[model samples]
Target: MLEEFVSLGKWWLPNNPEVVVPGKLSFSPVSGAKLELIGSFYSSQFEEIGQVEGIELPSDFVSIEENFNLTSRVRIDFIKPEEIIILGLLDNNEEITLYRCSGRMKSFEFVKNRPNLLFNIACIFRKIHFQDEQNIKLKSISVQYSHLEQWIGKSGIQAVILEEENKIWISYQPPSNIHLTKIGSLDLNITFSPINVNPFDFYLGATYYKANIEQKTYLTIQNPGNQPLDECINLLISFRDLLSFAMTKPTSVISVTGKTDVIQTKPIEQANGSITLKEELRETQVIIMFGLWNSEKNSETKLSPNEMLFLFSDVENSLGEVFETWIKKRETYESVFDLLMTTMYTPSLYLHYGLINIIQALEAYHTSKYEGIYQDKKVYEKGLYKKFLEVLKDFPSESVDNENGISDEFRNALKGKLKSQTRFTLETRLKEILSEIFCLLPPNFIGSLEARGLFARKASETRNALTHHDKEKRKKAGKGQELVQLFHTLTVILQICLLRELNIPDDSIKILVERNRVYQKEWRPSSN
Candidate 1:
């Protein structure tokens, strides 16, 4: 009979339901079973002996409930039986009835031809007391929250919580005083219910809900509203409570919405991914919205909706403007900018790549300047001969011919042809090429050659170590601090190169270099 009911119930109930019905039995087979329960009932027995002889009859009473007894049962249907079926009866409507009953199977018997199995059930029942619900609603609230130690800019964070009957709604507004007016991309970290309970359980809307304990999730919206800049954006989230231990398990839902007066509002898709912000020539404004559902586990628990908004704007600096100018003058400037932005964002990992790219950019510029010079056969031959003569200067006159297997004429021709190649060492080449690019030599160099020389040497060594796996040299690099310093110095060098390419005045370039050098000491690699 129980098996028939269990099969019928399985077909009648849905696989997963919002609410579970009462008197549902979920059964699983086991190998052996043991059940035990103890109960005590108390009563008093009194006997009066009537005696005419005695003036007063003494009443005698005995306590009948003082004895304690325990009942335990274990049953083995067969020797090494195939299986033992365990049954559990659920009182799903305990919230309405204010009562709970639990039972376990103690013994089982299987008959050869009988369709139903016989079993013994022991159950315990208890009544529950109802708790009074406390409701709290706040019209406006201010909450400051950040992924890092403090908020980035000087914007104030504000939030609000609204509760009507069993529904909860929260909204957080970020600071509006953004430094920029446009945004390219953004990332936000939202924490829901910083405490233990899952706030999404109370979500009360049409959206799907996935249960997460102490839920902390991140939602990123890109190209928001599909406009250049989103003027208004709204996000809705819903949560349903599966466990109904208190207050009938109210569903909580919230929506985060904000508007900006910026132009070119675009429609964006909602996504659950991360976006990396890059340095841009123009300022880009971004807004991050955070929604939180605050609730405690108690009859008089205070449920509050809290939210915070963060506004950030990426503004251009002098160095960035110089890069922008380079983009117009040089065809390869975009590649250089990509490397620079990558290094700026993730310095510890790609700073070396940035350094190498700067060198390449300078080389490209140099090659382009002398491209026409090399195209002229007369000038090319003259330059080649000049380089051959310079190479000959390193050897004694008598031994020059015997230095290699080639004759004097062939050797000279070969040296001349290869004169335009990279002849100087990396460090020497950096200093020499930088000197030419910046038009600074003796007394008016943007930075001291001695200081630049040191930087060049360290940069060369670090690059070599990173490329060739020089353990000793890498150990001397000292935990990337020197690498970061070298990266900053190289950045300044590139900035000077860009400024010179734009026909900027030498004095202005020097002033910019000096100003940026101060920031070098405090600049550290960031992964933001």
Candidate 2:
């Protein structure tokens, strides 16, 4: 056995071959090599332990692995106390096997030798295995649904289904207090069947549907499956009944405040009401309770402050035309549309998470369109490599050779050592890639090159802060309103980028971007 040697540095191994000893337990005079070990490696007897008497054995265990204790005593050359020394065993073949020691350094002693100082080190190795077994633990899981209230219809009602043990529970919750007059006329039911087992169906009639006079009522359906509940189960709901229940609304009175008088009005709720078609319409007070009222020309109607109504037949038609065109190029725009819709429909509370998702979606779309261009060896070497080098030139040096009075050759060697191992930070890398990609956009589309660069930097910083939970940076990134503006800005820019990659007409893209409310914000468009 050869005497064990030690290597020391910030990292486990040094990159400088000149400093490393070849086929021997020796090294060059390095300042960070605080200590060296000279000893023979030895192990104590191996011990086997059986299970406790009358205890059940684990199915996976046949026999417990033997445990042994390893110990070594070596002469430690204590060059510096603060620097850490990692000891390893060097074999006759010059192979170094480092010890995975959990024990701390102990029992330090000084040996006098003037400039050639050393210390006595006695390292102890203990083998202890502590395994924790718990009966139960809580885990967070995500739930996915096919439809949300806002996307389907603005009914303000949501349905969520959760699984526990062998039962599937479906609950329909209302946002506010409202009467369900059609509760008696409606049929509420749930059909649950495990695919692995026979069909298990459950139904609830109008009598089972519960409701209160003033407060909203929650309807729940619980169906126990015949088989054990796995991680996920296929669930289907009868949408006809659910949609009918969602579309019906309770009648309410409206009060209007006038300059001199207060007017209270009641709406006529007819079970079966019919309206005659008219070609022309004048400016008049016409209140629509429910159902579509079609018109060829525009007519203005006064509405209450809190009344929510949408008048966008023309806008809808225009958007439908654009969507039809996009569908023609579905492969180009489908992913972008999916992510954009997800961001748009994200709940207000999780807008930050939504922003991050949109950013990822942008990156994905960019890679999908231009990955070949970036990954081509010839193109990369000729174009992007030079650009990458230019960006790398701006990175600050992280040299570690100034403290000792070393020779110029060593200094230059260390400088080259630092340069060879240098790499760009994540933020710098993202900014460079984004800047290069955005350069392909139409000229002046994203303002100046400086603007593009700033966009990448800001976007990367905000994303990193949000991801790494840098509270100070995140707080300074923006308030809720500012984040909303930033979110809209990012979404619009990504949409535009996707369209441009699809080779859509610039005029059509401009029209789409300008007409959308998300792009109408005051925030300037940037690469982020």
Candidate 3:
């Protein structure tokens, strides 16, 4: 569901500032937030005294509707007490633009009906812009994660309860940040902004915390000659996805903002008196958002640090080690990465596909990270396969390749089959990934050795079942709670496989697996 941000203000095309249209800008979840304009064209046509242009309002709307590029609708700028930049204002609805004439005007102006405007969506930038461009320049990017404090488990205060004495004690102290990690050439720091709390506020029921602090982790590119906005956003979004994977749920980004520029100066003191100066960078800040990831949530789910795949101690922790490999192989792994991340937001009925997505993600992961060919084609082609093809080329149409005896076309048909025949099957690749990952973690992290074998067979068959809708394989495929267990198993496997790919130590990931609450809960596949 979309939250609402409404502004009652005047809107005008940047080029036609004199013809400001009085209207309100509204955004909601329904119909994806369209901004409607009332009395737009007729009001503009009747500017000042009654002087109608050669063209009629209705004709202009019709002409613009036919030729959208010919109109002055590149961007409709709105201003409340604060300014709003509305980019890409396309007419959203197919319904006729309503129109009604004024009661009386005594001139040609009265004849033109006022038409209403509806614009689909536009990126709303509340700050100033020097000029409009598809991509923006950024000095640095700041990102805040939902429940970051809960994930980091760091704060400025603690509460202690003595149940026997029926006494409660609260203590406040200074908060500190965790160690910073470097992703690619960028430095990632999780900084906190603490707000001083008063004990008196709790008695008034206006506040809940003894102390409040917010996590605003920011990234700065190392030795960047010209900081690229896209690069920063990539790392931000990539890490956000990793966090989503960690939380076992999709975590909304509280805010993502770019600071385009900053300036620093020292205050000056004159002989007559001392002077203090304060200033802000012009058009320096702009907030960025993806419409689907609305920050406001009706319900919140918080987890202990140990419950997540990402384990952090308030004393010692680093996320960069795992993320380093992710960034380098991000493009290669993008397909699988996106597939796995989507399952977090999937509906329950479609969760059967969640199992399917993990299987696809695993297959994709292996394809990208491992050689899909089970054996080299040249090895077989130069010897047995070559001999077989030579025999087929001259066979007198009485040969056998299988149940269907060979024809002259058999040679060419065999050539086509050879391409895929040399490649590994989904079952083989599944086992290979399983075998390599097993040595990296505790023995049977998913289950006992036999159970692990059963998981691999069922997963591979299920992949075949879902792909071709094979009835027999589908009968053996995971379903009901079995599907749920398999989904959880594949998730843990992918998470650990990625950790190993990143060169994270075996011992480190094993410790995370043992500590993880969900992994421990769902590790025993036989329980299902």
Q: For residues 186-232, could you state the per-residue lDDT of candidate 2 as single tens digits?
A: 21121111123123323332243543222121221122222211211
The best candidate by TM-score is 3
Off by over 4 Å in 3: 1-3, 28-34, 39-122, 127-140, 159-174, 178-187, 196-229, 257-299, 314-317, 347-349, 381-415, 443-452, 517-528
Could you tell me how far off, in angstroms, the CA of residue 220 lies in candidate 2 after the best superposition? 32
Instruction: State the local distance difference test value for candidate 3.
Output: 0.58
**lDDT: worst 10-residue window of model 1:** 238-247
Please write out the lDDT profile of model 3 over residues 257-363, one tens digit for every residue.
65555444557777879787656555356655334442345226655566677644522444655566666666768888778767765534376678788888889
TM-score of model 3 relative to the true fold? 0.67
lDDT of each candidate versus the true structure: 0.35, 0.35, 0.58
| Residue 141 accuracy (lDDT) in model 3 | 61
Better of 2 and 3 by TM-score: 3
Question: Residue 4 lDDT in model 1?
Answer: 12
Per-residue C-alpha lDDT of model 1 across residues 1-528, encoded as one tens digit per residue: 001112111101122233222233322111111222111010111122232342332345332223311111111121121111122222333211111222333233223211222222221111211121110111111112212111123323333445555544443333332121222332222223234444665675435454332222222222333432122122211111111101112222222222222223344444756554443332222222222222111222232211111111111223233323443554545554444433433424555676666555544444444332323556755776566667665644445545544556765776655654534456665666666655432233335556666656666776677767888888644245756566555655665665566566676556445443334342222223
Name the candidate that leads on lDDT. Answer: 3
Error of 3 at 402 (Å): 18
- Candidate 3, residue 447: Cα displacement in angstroms equals 5.5
